[model samples]
Structure formats: structure tokens, C-alpha cells
Target: MKLSKGANAPVPTSLLAVVVSWRSEHAVDAHALLLEGSGTVRSDRDLVFYNAPRHVSQAVTLDQEPAPRTARLSVSLPRTEADVDRIVVAGSVENGTFGDITGLTLTVHAVDGAVATFEIEDADAVRALMFGEFYRRDGRWRFRAVGQGWASGLAGLVTEFGVQVDDPADPARTTHPTDPFRLHRSARTSPSQEVRSARSATGAQPDPAPPGLRDRHDLAPVRHFPHGSFASDPPRRSAQSAREDGATGLTSDDVVVQRFSSSDDDADGRTGQEAAHNRSDASASVRPRTDLLDRAETAATLGSYRPVDLTRHTSETAPAAPPPPPNPDLADWHSDPEAPERLRWWDGTEWTSATCQHHPPSNRHCARCGHPLRRKLLGGLAPCQRCELEIEEYLTHWHTQAWRVLTTHGPRGPVWAALWASLRYQRIDADAGRRALRAVALSYVERLVTFTFADGEVQHAELELFEQAVTELALGGPLIEDLRRRMHRGRTLSRLRAGDLPVVRTPGLHLDPEEKVHVDLPATHVRQLARGPKLTEGRLIGSNKKLRFVGAGAGTEMPWSRIISVHAEQETVVIAATSSRGGGTFAVADPDYVAAALEGALRVAKRLVLTPGQRDTRSIPQEVKAEVWQRDGGKCVECGDGHYLEFDHVIPLSRGGATSATNLQILCRSCNRAKGARI
Candidate 1:
């Protein structure tokens, strides 16, 4: 049979099963409370079933099944050993209000096949509901459909029942009773005493206290007794009463009860009354003197009081005083004054239930911008609302730029500028920042050169392959060389000394008298030419007697007299000479003009060679020569001697070796002569 709200039914058998079911539309959780005689739970153990499940032997077992969204509790009255006098079944939505969910039902089954069902039709604004309770009554188990709810969910219910939740912020934290319920239970009056008190308050003669409860202070006084009891009999007269009853001497039944009276008490009462009257008369005499003194003082200060004109008075009410000004502190939530570590929510006029306990005030700032956080935005490190918005905007811009760069030739300058600015505010280590930059750069390179699946997504292996390709490219290109120079500039002096390089006072070059910069182009360190080298301030320079490179960290000069050959290849000018240091190569912004200037200064006979695939043994590019020279540090790589240094190709040209910096090596004249071309 279907049970209505507040309906009660008896449990006719020793064993019972209660099942609660709900639709999947709500993510509802189930809980069961084992209450004592009082409606509240006495301890955490009394809460039998929750997120953490437990079984109280074969007597009471709680189980939850997810397949059909149901929770079951089985109770065996015979084996139940705990002092649990009542069981309350409840359900709560995990993360939503119950007003949004529907189709909630609960059912109970007995061993004799008797069944009771309850349907919950409405639960507006409720987050948790107590569906029903089973209590022991009159030696029989009875079920009552309560259908009550709380908007504060399970946590509030736990607190209401005297359990102290350790951490309100963490719902899963342990709970325990604030104080034993037995202590409070001892102070309450018994049912019979309550009944007597009710009768006495209604003007009815109350029943006498039972003999067993007579000494208990919490019980009412004895008023009426049953007939034939000792309290109903008259008292026997003593010998003293007989002596005082001389005038009324008679048999015990005829003896009139002599009312006891005290002559000393009557005299004392009359004296107390006279003393009270005399004290009142003295107080009245002192009051007039006090009034005369007050009048004298008032007349001496401001003369006599003015007479009132009551006849001409008008009936008008004064305007109410203006309301007090609003308090600015109430506009924002702050930590509770009594509990400094816990936050308290203040809603303008009053405090609310909302509160938060996070990190101490010292650490409450934005992790990205270091701005003070008035409220928690996300994670442990609180971020102010404005900083949170800025962080989101920055991340979005970064992602958009990353996507664009990976797809096509995108503007990298702006991206780099943004990165530099972000470093000032973002709390990231130097290595992490560099890694992020490299990753973005590699991602772009990967999309530009690698093939993807049909859906345009690259696999892990494919991504690894692309990363390797980009890393290899970074080893020699302008990009890698620039990065290396930057890394060198940022390194400490210990690193430079460890490399066995001279610790120069200034890492920049000083220009010579006659040398002038013709064209300046920003250039990266060529591996074979410069190690930890700074940017060359002037890329291409001409002098009356030589060509010079005024670099920020180191300078190289090629005297016109020592120039054996000069070759122009694309945007590079290569020179081979007999100077103490092997000749250097350079990249110029205006390659053609630099080539012409070099030729005119050196008085070269042949026109500058500009075409590709020209095997000119006379000269190697200045960049290639500098790269080879710097790689060997102006010494022969084979012998480590600083004499007659020359640039030689590791792989001979006839063997299809490209005249690139990686293939070129520094050698002494003797070693070059020893290692002839294989052809």
C-alpha cells in the first residue's frame, strides 16, 4: 500500500528491508542515521550509512547499488545489538538543488510480505530530504513517513544532530559528537513528570511522586495520594500534645486538633512591621531635604525654572531622527573577528552562512601577477578577479598565436614581445620559460614541414620526429646562434672561466681609426667562428687598408695586403687570407655593395663570384671561415697549435660535401697538406 506523508505502519516481522530509488536525472546520494531515543544522533557512529559505508553485523546492513540508482538497508531486529532506537533514511543531490529533480520514491518490505511505499512529489528548494524513519514503539517496530528536508544538505543535518564536522570546507572530513548526548539526556524530565507538570499548570491536583522517585529533585512535589496508603492516615497524638490539651481533653476521635501558634513569632512580626514604618518615614524626610538642596544648586547656577505655557501648546510630532550612515566595512566580506583564519560573509546589513577558510592572509595573492587577492578565484593561491581576467586573456592570446604560427607564416615579433612582458609578471623559472618558447617554435616548424593524418592530427611519434628535426635545425641556423649568444650573455663569469676562454674586461670591440661601418646586420654566432660571442655591432666595415668586423664581444680584421682571395656567395662575403688568424666570413644587409667594397679595397682582379655551385678554391665565405676559426680557437684542430692556421673541409668537395660551417674545420698548413683531397 502507498503511504502518504506522516503515515505510520507497524513492522509485523523481525526482519525488514528498506529501499530508496531515484531517477538518473539527479545525482543523489543516500544516508541513514541511527538515532537514539531522542530524535538527534548521539555520535558519528550513529550515522550508519554515508559516503563511507558500514555494516552493523547481521542486525543492520546498509548497501548502495548504482545500476538502478537505489540504496538498501536491511534490519534484523533479533540480532540488532546496538542501542540504536531509531533509523532515519535520507537522500541528497550531490551538487544540485532538489527542486530540479523528479521521480523520487522509497519503499519498505517486511518478512510477512507487507509492503509500504512513499512517493515524493515536491521538494522545492531542498538539497537534502529525510524520507522516513523506523522506530521501536510498544515492543513493535513502526515506520513513519517524515518527508522532511533541509536546504543546507547533509552537512547542516549532521551539525544539527550534535555532530561536529571538523572542516566545513571539506565535506569528507571526519565528524564526531561535540559532547555526549547522554549528558544532555540526563537533564531532561521523564514522561510522567511532564504529565504531572502539565496537570498542575492547568489548576488540577497533581499526582504524588512515586516512592522510587521521591528523592529525585527533578520531580514535582507530592500533592495527592491513593486511598489506604500511609500518607492518607491521621497522625497519633504525642504526650506533649496531651499536656497542652488540658481544656479539650477527650478520646482520640473527639480530640479537636489544636493549631500550633508561637507567641514569640507574633511579637517579632509586630516589631518588624514597626521598624519598616519608621525606616519609610525617615526616607520620606530625607527626600525633601535632597529636593531643597537640588533647588538651591539650580537657583545658584541658572536662576529658577521658567513657567510652562501649556494653554498655547500645539499638537505636532517632531521628525524622526535620520538613519545612521552606511558602514563601508559591511560592503565586503572579511575574516571573522573571533576567528582570524576563517572568512565570514557579510551582506551589507547582516552576516550570512557563507564562509571560507583557506591559506593565511600572507599568501593570499595572485600567483601570476602578485596582486593582492580579496577573494579566491581558483586553486590554492588566490587570484584577484581582475588578475584572473588578465590571465585568461593572456592565455587566449598565446593559444591563438600558437595556432596561427603552426598553420602559416605568422607574426612572431609580437609573440616574442608578449613573452618578454609576461616574464615580468608570471611566476615561472628561466628554464621553463625557455622550454615554453622552444616548444611553440618547434610546433610551428612541425606543421610547416611534417605530414599529418587524414584528420590533420599528428601522432606522438610524428610529433617526436618533428621535434627532432627542429632541434637539429636549431643547432646551426640564425635562430639557434641568436639563442646561444643570449644564453652566453646571461651566464656567470664562472661559466666563462670554466670554458678556458679569456675573461675580457669589456666584451665589445673598439673601432680602429680608419675603419668605418658600411652595413650593419644583426647576426647569430656561427658555430665554427664564435663561441659565446655577442652580436657583431657592425656586420660589414671597410678601412683604407683592411676589412674589419666590430662585434659586441670580439672583433676580427682582414688586412687588404693579407687577402689571398675574396668570393661573394648569395648574401655572404667569404675571404681567404694569410693573416695570423684564419680568415672570417660575414653576412651583410647589402651583400652586393659589401662585395663591391671588398673587391675595390683588396684590388681583386676577377669579378665577385655570386652564382651558386661555383667551386672556388680561392676563398671561403667569411661566416664559414669565422665559424671554423672560432671552433678551433685560432689553432689547428688536429695538433692544437696556433701556427699557420687554415680552414679545411672535413668532407672533400669531390665527395659531394657542401661548403657549410658544419663540414668545415680549422687546420694548420702542415695538416692541410697532409690531408689532401681523396680525388
Candidate 2:
């Protein structure tokens, strides 16, 4: 479809080719800037032009070969950095103004036949034109036909976006005619050779590299500027350039173009066939693209097809497709014979004791997750509308409290009911707690669901409760689907755990029927202070009874009650068993998770909570220390460093990990404090 200046169109694909075609001998070079939401380039590496032909992430690149005179930029939107807001497609003239050219059009081509073109009508004596921008809107990508230009040229344009380009006007720097000019000039520019320093916009020294990128002094010099810290480049003609650019954004990406035509039959009363033949080609200049084949023989051999005509000669009209059935998880008021004064709460599937009066107000926010209560079933929500609580905060605080409540009292039982009642949300009823209890209910239900799916199965009673919660909370299909996704992953993990036992070649491995499997992961035993070949490949399995590894010709078993210390060093799990043989360092999948499972299982096995060796405050619980010792085999579980030992929680206690043996582990001083908050 054709677009006017300031009008926009949706780019329908992640991969596209943006071609700027103009009628002129003047050299016009295409350039793109990866801008942050603050409307400035993140770094000089974000500038992709002839000087920097490829973006650091390869999200945008100037095509090495272009068709005749057109300039093309290949875009891979998915490869773009998460913080990158948009790609500004601009062009600079090294020789003449854009006014000297004709047919100035920017076209974007998708893999499919979707094409969007914007034509520049009035000519202006500008050195650069912002052809358009491929930007993100509500999570989807779109293009806005800016057709805005600046009189300050390419060097001035680069300076506007937080870059200190070697200015041509300074006379100290020589000009690089990167263009259609490259085809005729002696010197060709390479991104690495023509590189400018991509420092902070404030001209501060570049910040230290990200933690993951640090300590590798041999890596390439890609830079990042902190968000909200990029102060505008001073002495740049940004203000004056903005004044010359008159482009204004249009309403939306989904533009509709209507076609109105006057046929011969409708206008001059001629036949339909005559109108088509007469209008087939008004002039010889319009010709069929017969480049692919010349043979009419192929056309004769092709299959014949006809369009379906529903309005033509049918005995009866075809029934219109019935609209989809309303959502099963619907909430509406239903009449009750017993209470004529009030309608009963029909939570989609059944009559609920909750009255319409008990329903939360529209503005109520969840006290638990801090997510807003859905105002109505299947309705839209405010974008990014979240309360002050971060997800980590919820996990650490409210979620922990809820889990503790469940651990003390079984789900769907009387104690569980009492805990729900004691939620004490005081919103519309009094303080800021109206309808907040429902989020608590959701949280508790989530825990129950997780526990139930641990065995790879869900009871019918559990499904009913889940459905009731959905209807009561006015949840939509997407949220329901997400819950199902959680269920599926849990079930998959459970089944994999169950499969781990049968593969053990060591026939001595056995489990009582009551012993529930908690952890099952591939492991390789690491022998400390060994002569050679430290690893003994095996499968590590844990249950409420014991921790054991069974491999080719080797086997090791440690009863949970006999374990002393459990440690995680890097990617390995070490268990110090008091009377167990074959106990050593085991490199396993997610050592922390294995350590957690072992501690929890040990607590269940021993049923005791106290550390005899701990002579300190309650910060390191006595019960947790005892279990960690039993699970880790009475030594520093990490690195076999028996000295300078410390007790660590596999999953921090604040994040809902149990305080008993399950969460505790042993670590040496260096291993425990290696990663600060990241650990």
C-alpha cells in the first residue's frame, strides 16, 4: 500500500528488506540508528552506516550489493537487543540535496507479498531524510513513514544521537564519502577501520563491562550506555534539526485503503467483459511481467479452477457459522429461592456462598502478587499496570508466608480454611485490603497445584477447586492456559524422575514402597585427592529414605539419617556420609536443586531439627544445621575443604525454601561468598 508523509504501516515480518529508490545520479547512503526509548542511540555501535555497516547484534546491516542505484538495509528484528526501542532508517547525501532527486520512495519488503511504500512529494534542499523507522508498539513491530529531513548533513545527523563524529566542518578531520559514492571513490570504508569511540553520551569514560563480559580481556570492544543516563550531546544542532523536520506520526499501524472504480457497465452501460478488455492496459507502457516463461503450452496444461459463489443458485442459504460458545469460566448473578432479597453468586459452574456484595471492587489490587484483580471476565487490562511489589518481593514475602501455612496445615482441610479466613485484607471493607484475600486464595491454590502435580497426576477434586478460583477471580483463557503450562512441566519432570531408577545397573539399589522420589538427576562422581580420572559417571537419586548413586560397576548409598554435611561447589554436589561407602563429590545438573532436595528429604527421614555443633545465634537454625550435616556427610560439601566451613541455604529461606534440612547446605568460606547477591 502507498503511504503519505507522517502516515505509517505495520511491518508484517521479523525479517525484511528496506529499499530506498530514487531517480538521480547523486550518491545517497542509507544509515540506521538503534535508539533507546529515550530517543537517542545507545552507543556509537548502534549507528549502522557505510562506516559501521553491521550492527553489533547483526539486527540491521547495510547490504553489500544493491540493485543499480537503490540502497537496501536487511533487518532482522528478532535479533535486536531487548532494550532497543526502534531503528531509524535515514539516508544522507554526500554529493547533492534530496531535492535534486525524483521518485524518492522507501519500500519495505517482507518474505510474504506484503509491501509498504512511502513516496516523497514536495522537494526540499535537505542533506538527510529520515525515510521511516521500524519501531515496536505494544510488543509488535511497525514502520512510520517519517519523510522528515535535516539541512545539517550526515556528520551533523550523527552528532545528534549521542555520538562525537569527526566533523567535516572542523577541517581537522577529512570527509569520507560513503555512498553510491563508494562505487566511484578510491577509498572504501570498513566498520572496524572507520570506528569511532562509543562512549557515554555525557562524554564520561565508558562504564565497566557487564559482569559476564568482564575478565575476558581478549573480547571485542562493544559498549553499552546505562539507561536514563545518556545526557544529550552538547554543541549538537539537535534543536535546529528538530525544527526542520516537519513529520508527525499518524494514528495506527493498521491502515485501510479503499478502492472505488467506475466500470463500463456501471458508467457508460457497456458489458463487463468490454470494460475489463478496455482497461486491461491504458497504454503500452504497462506490460505483463513475462520474464519467467515464454511458453503458452504450460498455461494450456495447467489445472483449471473456479472461485466459489455462495450467492448463486442455491436451494437454500448456507447456514452461517455459529458464533463460539461463551466462556465456561463466566461469572454472573443467579436467582436463589431461599434469598429473594439477594441474588446468589454463580461462579460460572456452581452457586457460591459469596454474594454479589462480597465481590471485590473494580480497582482492587492483589495483596499477594500485587497484580490487579480482573475487573471483568475476558476484558482488557491496563498496559504494564503493576503495583509496587516486584515478583521477587512477592516470592520472598507473601509466597513464603502462604507456603508456610500449607506446610503446617494440609490443603483443602479445616486448618487451610482457617488460614484463608485470617488473611486480613482491609481494602474496601476498611483499609487497602478489599478483595485482596482472593489473591491469597490464588497463591495457596498454586502451591496445592504444584504439590499435586509432583506425582505427575492431578486428582478430580483439585481440578474443581482450580476452576472455581478462575471463575471467582474473573480469569481469561490466557491465564488458564498458563496454569496448564505449569502443570505440564511439573508432570514432565516427575515422569523423568520416576524413570531414573530403572536404569541403574547396580541391582542392589532398592526403595521401599513408601519412599517417595524427590530428586533424580544425571551425575558424575568426583574423587577428591585422587591419582587420575576423578569422575565416576552415574545417576544420582534421592528419596525420603536415602541418597544413592548407581553406575556401571560402582554404587554408593547413604541413608538420610547418616548424612552429616551437604555442600554445593560450582556445578557439583558433595555429601559427607558418616557410615556410607562410595560417598564423594558428584557433579550434577543444578547442584543447588539437588542440595535442596537432599536436605528436605533428610528432614523427612530424621524428623529432628537441631544442630549440636552450632554454638551461635538463631540466624543459622540448629535444626537446619543438623540436617545439612547429615546430608553433606559431615564435611564441607563443596571442594572437600573441611576447614573454614559455613552453612548455606540452597534456596534462600526468604524465597519460600523450607528452613529445615531441605534448604540448608554446607560451604567453605570462599565457595559460600564467591558470588554475592547473584548466589
Per-model C-alpha lDDT, please?
A: 0.46, 0.50
Candidate 2 to truth, TM: 0.29
RMSD of 2: 32.4
Model 1: how far residue 31 lies from native, Å = 1.1
lDDT tens per residue, model 1, 1-679: 7889999887754777777777756676666776666666544444555433553234566675544667777767655433457777777776787677667788887876647898887766788788888787744578899888888877676556644444535544422111100011112654345436656777856434322222334333222111111222333333223223321111101100000011111222211001100111212111111111122122212211211111212235332322222442222335555455544434222343322332343576543333465743664644455433433433444444434433332322222222332322222233443444465554444222212211112223334344444553342456445433333332322122122122122225455664444323443224253566433444555544456665666767766677775555555666777874536666666544455455544542233322322223434564555455556665678898654455667887657877778887766657876886742
Q: Which numbered prediction scores highest in TM-score against the true structure?
A: 2
What tens-digit string does per-residue lDDT give for candidate 2 at 164-235?
564324544432211000111113432211111324333644333321212323232322211011123322
Task: Compute the lDDT of residue 555 as modeled in candidate 1.
Answer: 66
Query: Which 10-residue span in candidate 2 carries the lowest summed lDDT?
Result: 250-259
Q: How many angstroms is residue 124 displaced in model 1 relative to the true structure, after the best TM-score fit? A: 2.6
